[model samples]
Target: MFCYQCEQTDRSDNLLLGCHSVKGNCGKDDRTATLQDVLIVICEAIGQYAVLLREKGVVDPTWAHRASYWVFTTLTNVNFNATVFQRMIADAIVLRDELKARYEAACTEAGETPVVPEGAAQFVPDPGMAGLLKQAPLVRVDANIDVLGADVVGVRNLNLYGLKGLCAYAHHAHALGHRTDETDAGIEKALAFLGDPPTDLDSLLGHALELGSLNLKVMEMLDAANTGVYGTPVPTQVRVTPVEGKAILVSGHDLGDLAAILEATKDTGITVWTHGEMLPAHGYPGLNKYEHLAGNYGSAWQNQHAEFAAFPGPIVMTSNCLIEPQPSYRSRIFTMGPVGWPGVRHLEHKDLGLLVKAAQALPGFATTDPERSITVGFGHDSVLANADAIVEAVKAGDISRFLVIGGCDGAKPGRNYYTEIAEKSGDDTILLTMGCNKFRINGHDYGTVAGLPRLLDIGQCNDSFTAVKIALALADAFDCGVNDLPLSMFVSWFEQKAAAVLLTLLALDIKNIRLGPTLPAFLTPAVVDVLVDKFALKPLGDPTEDLANAMAGA
Candidate 1:
């Protein structure tokens, strides 16, 4: 098996390229990796037909939405159950076949000859698990790397990973009754191009950037979905310390599941605590109204092994970044949506009867912990509403710059760069960020800039639109372009959602982005050179040096 789709892909001395051993850094076994590869091949095939069917208006968005959610399942740290992947593979083939038939029928009914897609789109998976596993090596991500060269394959990974990011965010939007035809069609179009990939380097790069531009729209849709369902988030104080009660800790990036769990357990003597990306839910008016939706716990996804094991009650993961569950907490931990682990119980249709029972059966907090609080809910609308004061502060020298440091966080070493950068950003600079990356610097107090909180936690990675919108509003208030603002973006990436966010930033023509813990393993030297030269992107450097350069306009 071969995989290098995330920031934590094996990069040790021997295997320097990607994970090729019995297991990946994310703890997915070889069998699950191979099955995901097989399913990825299916998503490409579905894209080939879904793109055309969308154009013809032959079928509704059933297949397009299905393909989007299906690809999401293959993202890093999402699903680790090989048996679940086997079932998804079986179901995907039948879905792809039905989509193909519908596309053909639409062409025939219109009296036009249909052109069948070739390569992965036309091929069918072998029967059963063993046969499919046998086919896995043939369709692995790097199958054509030797022929197409690393540059071409690198760009292809860009497109494919970008597709994964878009689909993952789109799934979040769809969950909140938000859907846009353009976003759905763009996902299919990118998938179709990847099905029979082009060898032209420029075409591949352009397609990848298009996926980036499209991802911005998906992020916006997600922002709208969250705000439309829950009220727009406002500045609010959230208790980080434990509240007294039988508690349930809900982690990951799904607010819908969090809201459902809150409603299900309302006044039942159980206090629901948010974790990881779910920490920002405390700021939403709709969710905060529940007296029992108490406080956030722990840090980012990578720290879950320790935090989950210590939590006194059952923990629920509503989205990505589920690691191998420890034996101690395996039974009490539950998986929801596309997140899955082999022995962990899964939550379906927001049903938490079993989870509720588990929560009651386990001992919760014995008493109230110390009152520790952190202020969240500084979303785009919230920041923009304070635009006048922020602009005034910048002009009066109260705020020197806006250092936007954010994106996904992982278990790697160099991630401390984000921490140091934010800490040294100084009180004169406003620290803007989102996702678990904030965990690096949020623990320290940078104080306020112009009466506005220094570190702005917009929300989860899904709330990326808020950061961009805040930047644009700041630029507008300053009467300058976004690139001209005194802003420096340092993005820490761990998975595809971060990939999507980077693409959106690049597509908006944002420049001087400092990306790290390391460049993606999938990017060859040539592709890296091309990105650096084209977008003026820079690899992460020493925080002191980078900060000086950012201040000196280097």
Candidate 2:
């Protein structure tokens, strides 16, 4: 097994670059790791076939969504069930063969000999696990590194990983009934690029930056999907304390499934609560309309083992980042929409009947706890609507600087750095946060300045687009470019999606981003140097020192 798709990969001597042991740092075992690699190789072939069909005016938009799902399913800690992958693999092969036949026919009609491809584009998976495992070694990440050099391999992986993260965002938007012509074409184009990668290092690096530009468009699609379906997010205080009643904790990043469950259990007296990244659901107008949709229930995803066990009702994980459920609550946990564990019940067709009934039977928190809450819904619309006031605050000395502290959260040791920075931020500084990392320092009371909450909670990690929007709006209000604005980004990354977002920032020529709690292991030293020299990327150091550096020019 070999995997280095996330920040938490093994770093022990001889394992600095990736994990080749029985299990990855995130608990993915050998079989699952090998199957994931095989699945990606299959996706590349599927894209190759799809692109070939595009030459005949046979554009299939659904393939883009499918490609998005394939990449999303391979993200770290997303899908662990090998059976699910096997089914997807079988389907992809059938489609590939069908498209190949069509492409060959097109060539024959034109009196041209079709060139059959080798490698991943023409792979035929062996029926059994042994055969599949045999093919895995040939397609693993390190397969071409020796010949292509680490710099080239690293840049290629950057594009691949960025595409994975972009597809994850695109998948979420597709769930809400959103799609566009460019989004579809871009998805297939990027997948096919990876299907037949370029050998030139400069070309690969250029494609990586192109992915960053494409991600910007993907993020916009998601932004529209959320606001159009759920109504623009508004500032609303979400209760962190439990209310009395039978509760169902909806976790992960799926707002659609949460909406369904809320509708299903509206009159049942079984209250609905959010966990992990689902915390932001409380701010959306469509979701907030449910009176029974109670407040957030847990901290970050890493604390789920204890949090899920302690909760009295069933938990529904609608998306990725699902860990191995403890035996105590594994019986009550339900997985849906690409998230799976060995023993947990998988919900089909977004059904919550079984899980809802379980919640009704369980004795939920019988009494209401102390009222403690946090204000959310500071999305792009919310902040930009008050652009004039924000600009005035800056001019009047009410606001000194702005800090964008957002990204994925994890169980790693250095995560306290986020909490410290947010805490140490002066009253004159406004903190804007998103993603699960907000859980680290969101509870603090940073008083409002210029009629805005000091710490603004932009929607989810996918809502990083909101930060970009707010930044540009602020820059426009002050008549300057984004880089010239008094804003600093101290991002925390734990997974590939964060890496993709970082690439997007660089693609926009937005520089001076300080990334932490650790850099990606997939990036060799040479690759890191390129990013530093080109984009002014910096690593997180002492909180005070980093903060000082961030405020130096503000």
**lDDT of every predicted structure (CA atoms):** 0.87, 0.86
Cα RMSD of all models vs. native, in order, equals 1.3, 1.4
lDDT tens string, model 2, 1-554?
A: 87777877888854347888888888888888878887788888777777777876778788888878877988988888888888888887777777788889988998988766555786677889988888777778767777888778777888888999999999999999998878888888788888778888779888888888889899999999999999999999999999999999999998888988898898999899999899998989999999999899988999999999999999989888888888898889898887877767888654668877899889999899999999899889888888888899899999989999989999999989999999988889999999999999898899988887899999789999999989888888899999998899989998878877987898889989999888887787888898899888888899998898888852
Worst 10 residues of 1 by lDDT: 7-16
TM-scores, all candidates, are 0.98, 0.98
Per-residue lDDT, model 1, residue 202, is 93
Q: Write the per-residue lDDT of candidate 1 for residues 1-554, one digit (tens) a residue.
A: 88999987887754348998889988988899988888888888888888778778754666667888889999999999999988998898998888888888999999999888987787678877788778776788888777888778878888889889899999998888888888878887888888898888999888888888999899988988999999999988999887766999999998888889998888689999999989899989999999998898999999999999999999999989899999989889999999999888899754788888888889999888779888899998888888889888888988888988888998889999998898777779998889999898888877877888888888888888998988888888888989899898999998998888888888888989999989888888889898899988999988999999997665
Residue 117 lDDT in candidate 1: 90
Candidate 2 runs further than 4 Å off: 14-16, 115-119
